[model samples]
Structure formats: structure tokens, C-alpha cells
Target: MMADLREMYTFEFMRYALTVGVFGGGMLAFLGIFVHLRRIVFLGAALPQITALGIALAIALHLPLLVGAVLGGLVGILLLSTSGKPGHLPTEGWVGLAYASGGSLAIVVLALSPHPDAGALRFFTGDVLGTNRAEALFAIAVAGFTALIFRLCWSKFVVSSFDPVMSQTLGLKVRRWNALLFLCLGFGLAAVMNSAGSMLAFGMLIGPPAAALMCFRAFPKVVVTTVVLGAGAAFVGLTASFLFDLPGGPTMATAALAPVLPAWIYRKIRK
Candidate 1:
């Protein structure tokens, strides 16, 4: 098995896929902690769909797909944030609405396009194995940016998430912090959805963090464990896909669940 794995990485495409999966998976898992802790898992599901819609639109308009994706994700984030306030549509409702709308819009856009299969549509579902060096670099850059933001505002983000009132009491701009966090989430989703597809990206965003929460209570430990598990899942899943000739994105997503189920069951039994 080790020999096969080593031989597989001899190819440039395999190396690129592995690099993307590791960095992209780690970034998704790191951001997922906020989604899980804030009880906003729906965003994990919704934003990616919105980004897919953007990719479809970009294809139709002959624009850069990444630009379309980021714009679409940002629009979704803005809409959700605006309507998600108290005395408005609840966050889950907004997220559900966005998900459905985005999926429908993507289908409509593709159906109306002159060339539906212009190859960009693969991003909607994912094409992780097709990732090139440039996309991998973009993924790395986004991950680095996310890490910097988290490092600088770690306490503010945690405080804003756990206690908005406390954040305000401490003279923090709660809304600003929340917006920054959501922006980072949107950026990460857009960056990965192109390579990993919306579905796999969403899985990475939720699965590892969920598993980590089951295994640890300390915030730092949970964050570190989530990153490790996500990266590991991506690596294993990519290897399996190469060996079995399976779809890379879904394989990785399914692999991410491997550790989660056992950890969840253990936590339940302990409880």
C-alpha cells in the first residue's frame, strides 16, 4: 500500500491534488469550528451552493469563475446577515432559502447557456483531481490569509461568537467582528468550491469540526485536532480515489465522516 501510494505521487496531477486537499481541507475545518459553535451549519451548506451558482453564471458570461464564485458567496453572506437579525427571518430559514434558490439558479443558468458543458459545470459538483498548480497556490494563499485573520482576531471572534453582549461591553464592534468572520467564511468557501466542489467543501467545513468537538473540550485542542483530521481525511480519500478510480471530491467527503461517526458514538456512549 505504501509503495502504491508513493508511486501515485510521482505524477504532477496527483501531487497537485494532494496539496490542494491538504490546504483546502485544513482551512475548511478551521473555519468550520465557528460554524458549528455558532449553530450555523446551514451556512456551510448554503454558501457553497450560492458559489456554484456564481460559477455557472461566470461560465455563461465568459467571466472568471473565481470572481463569480466569490461575488456569489459574498452576496449570499450579505443577504443572510441582513435578514438574520432578530425579528426577521431566522438564520436557518435564510440559509435554506439561499440553498434552494442557488441550486435552482445554477440549473437554470446552465440550461440556458449555449454550451452547458463548457467544462465549468464540473466545479458545481467538484473536480478535485483536475486541480492545477495555480489553483493550488490560490488555495494556499487563502488558507494563509485565513490563518492570519484568525491569529489576529482570535479573542475578538471568540468573544463575539460566545457573547455578543460581552463583546459590546468590552467595547468591541460586535457587528464588525461578525462581518469579518462571515467574510472569511465566504472567501474560504469560494476558494475551495472551485477545486473541491461545493459538496466536498461543505463536508470538510462541518465534518472534522464536529468530530473534534466530540473528542475535546479545550478550544485550542479542538482546533488543532480538526485541522489534522481534515487533512488526514483528504489525503486518505485522494489516495483511495487514485487507487480505485473513484470520484475524488465525494471520496474525500465520505472519508471525512469515517472518524466523525466513531467519535460521535463514543461521545454518546460516554454521556
Candidate 2:
């Protein structure tokens, strides 16, 4: 078993895949804390679909995939954030619209691509094994940058996120902080969705954090446990995919979500 596990990394592709899984998955999980705390879980769902639409457009137009993904995610965040006007369809209404249209349009656009590559559709279905070193490095860079920013401005983020009114009273730029948080979310989602697919990216965003919040009430512990679980899920899912010849992205998604049940059970029992 040990030899088999060690041999998995001997292959270059596997190394890249693992690196992406660990860093990207962990980052998404970390951002998920804010998603949950801010009560914008639906926004989390919507962004990935929108990001997928971006990838499809990129493929159809022969643009760079990463460019498409980042732009798409950023656009989605910007549009959604500015929504919820006095008489508009409400923020959730817009989120639902984006969530519904983004996924469907992605497929339609792909179908209409004049020259679709066979591997292009992997953006939706996921193709972690196809991840290259550059993408892996991108994942690491994004994760590291996210961590650094959050670390330096932890108080401002927490204040702005948990109590925007109070944050404003304190003379902090709440909107800027909110924008920065969403920017991080956009970049992190695009990076993960680029290689791991929207499904795994969303799973990592919601799952480990959900589970960790269930198990712990302390903020720091919740964050640490969430990151650990995210990374662990990636390792387990990749190993399982290798041994069982399963699809890498969905398998990792399943692993990321697996902790929810146990954590919920523990919460119930403790209650």
C-alpha cells in the first residue's frame, strides 16, 4: 500500500494533480467560512456556474481558459454584488438566475463551438489528471496570496463581514473589504474550476467548512480543521480515484463532502 501510494507521485501528472487538489481545495474551503458566515452560500453556488460559462466562452472563442474563468467569475461577483436594488428581483433572485443560466449556457456555447476539442468538455465534467504544472503553480500562488491577505487583514475582514454597520462606524472601508473578499473568492473559484471542475470547486467551498463549523465553535479551530479536511479529502479522493479507476474531480468532491455526515451526527449527539 505504501509503495503504491509513493509510486503515484512518481508520475508527473499525478504530482501536479495532487498539488492542485491540496492547495486549491484548501483555499476554497477557507473562503467557504466567509461564505457561510456571510449567509451567501447561494452566491458560492452561483459563481462556479458562472465561471464555467466563462470557460465555455473561452473555449468557443479560442481565448485562454484561465482568462475566461477569472473574467467570468469576477463579472458574476460584480453583478451579483451590485444586485438587490430597491425594487429589483432581490439578491437571491439574481443568484438563482445566474445559477440557472450559467450552467445551461455553458453547454449550449460548447455545443456551438465551431471546433470543440474532445478534452474541452472536461471543464464541466472535471479533468484533474489533465492538470499541468503551470496550473498547479497557479493554485499554490492563489492560495498563498489569499492566506497572506486574510492574515494581514483578519480583523478588518471579520469586522466587515460579521458587522458591516459596526465596521462602518469604526471608519473601516467595509465595501472595499467586501470587494476584496469577493475578489479572492472569484480568483480561488476560477483557479480550482479551471482544472478540478465546478463540481469539485463548489464542493470544496461548501463541504469542509460546513463540516468544521458543525464540529467546532471556535473560529481559529474551525478554520484550521476546515483546511485540513479539505487537503485530506483531496489526498483521499485522488488515491481512491487511482485505485478504483474513478473520475478524479467528482471523487474528490465526494470525499470533501463525506465529513458532513459524521460532523452532523456528532453535533446532534452533543445537542
Candidate 3:
């Protein structure tokens, strides 16, 4: 179990890759609680595609790729929160539009190139084994930011999640918090996409959190459980990919799903 990871740590690139995956896993697990509670599952796919379009546009314009991804995700976030208002469509419809348009743009841009697979893999699946030291430092910073956000809104976010109306009655500014949640989610989404690629980020964002919530009964317990499950999955997936010559993103998702299996089986037996 530890051999692959130990070997991975000896190399500078693999060390960073594992570091990024760990921080990325923790961050996603943290934010995913809010995402799931808010009933915003589609944000996983929508935000990533929007960032992918940003990457494509950056390639087209020769600007900073990360900037394009962040800006694109922010635009999508704005549309998600404010679209279909003032005599326009609904937020759901707006999200659908952005999802399609951004994903389409990315696909088109990638297809126009001579070799699309490598580019697609790098942008969507992530190169976890080849991550650099700088990227690892960036991941740590992002993880710290995630921790800060969670600390600031620990109580309010929990109250709002369980009962928005009661929170509002208590002068909790639920709407403002919800908006702020979306903004933090936007930043989290952007950060993970750059570090882990869209698919790994999306899976790690939802999968381990979902699994942990299914296992734990209390809020604080759920947070610890989710983070543990998420980081564990990342470690397992990284090792599996390295040993089996598998891709990083899908393997990480598979590892995440591993923890959910026992619960699912028990549910089936009870049913």
C-alpha cells in the first residue's frame, strides 16, 4: 500500500502530484458539503466546462491559461446566480446554456488541433504524476483558503443549509450567505480545475463527500469523515494509476466510489 506512494515521493514531480491530490481532495470534500446541501450538483460539470472554454480561449489568444479558466468560471458563476432575472430565463436554463456553449467551444478548439487526445487528457483528466513543485505550493495555498472560508461561515453556513427560513428569521442574511457561498464555490471550482483537471475535481468534489455523509450522522463528524475518505481515495487512486498505467482522473473517481460500495450493498440488503 505504501510502496507506490513511497516511490512516488522520491521523485520531485510525483511528490508534487501527490501533494496536489491530497490538498485538492481535502478542498473538494470541504466545499462539496455546501454544494450538495445547496442542490447544485450540476455545478460540477458546468463550472469545469466553462473553465475548459477559458483554457481554449487562452490558447487562442495566447494569454495566461489559468486567468482564462478563472474568469470563465466567474462568468458562469454570475450567470448561475443572476441569469433569467429582470425578465429573462431561470438560473437552471442559464446554467444549461453555459454548459453547452462552453463545452462545445472546448471540444471545437481541441478538435481543430492535430493531436487532440493528449491535450484533452491534460485538460480534462489531469497529469497528476507530472505535477510540479510550484503547482503543489499553489494547491497548499488553495487548501488554506478553503479552510479559511469554512471557518468564517461554519455556523452560518450550517444553519442556512439545514433551514434557510429559520436562519433568515434569526437575521442570518441567508441570501447574502448563499451568494457568498456561490462565490467561494466559484473560486474552489476554479482552483480544483486547474490543479486536478475537471473530471478529478468534479469526482473528488462530490464522491467522497457523498459517501461520508451517507456514513456519518452528525455535521462535525461528517466533515472529518469526508475529508478522510477523500484524501484516502486520492492516495489510493494515485497509487493505482502509477502501478497499472491508468489515467489519474478516472482512477481517482474509481477509488472514491470504493468507500461507497459497502453502504450501497447494505442498503440493498436492507431493501
Task: Identify the candidate with maximal lDDT.
Answer: 2
lDDT of 3 by residue, 42-113 (tens): 766687788888777766666655676678777777767766676677667777888898888886876674
**lDDT values of the candidates?**
0.86, 0.94, 0.74
lDDT tens digits, residue span 34-153, model 1: 999998888778889898898788878878777887898898888878876888778788889999999899989978977556566677656688888877887888889889989998
The candidate scoring highest on TM-score is 2
Count of backbone clashes for each model? Answer: 0, 0, 1
Ranking by TM-score: 2, 1, 3
The whole-model C-alpha lDDT of candidate 3 against the native structure comes to 0.74
Report the Cα lDDT for residue 3, model 2.
98
- Model 3 TM-score relative to the real fold: 0.87
Better of 1 and 2 by lDDT: 2
Candidate 2 has its poorest 10 consecutive residues by lDDT at 115-124
Q: Write the per-residue lDDT of candidate 2 for residues 1-271, one digit (tens) a residue.
A: 9999999889999999999999999999999999998999999999999999999999999998888899999999999999999987988999999999999999999999986888888878877999988889989999999999999999899989999998899899999999999999999999999998999999999999999999999999999999999999999999999999999999999999999999999999999
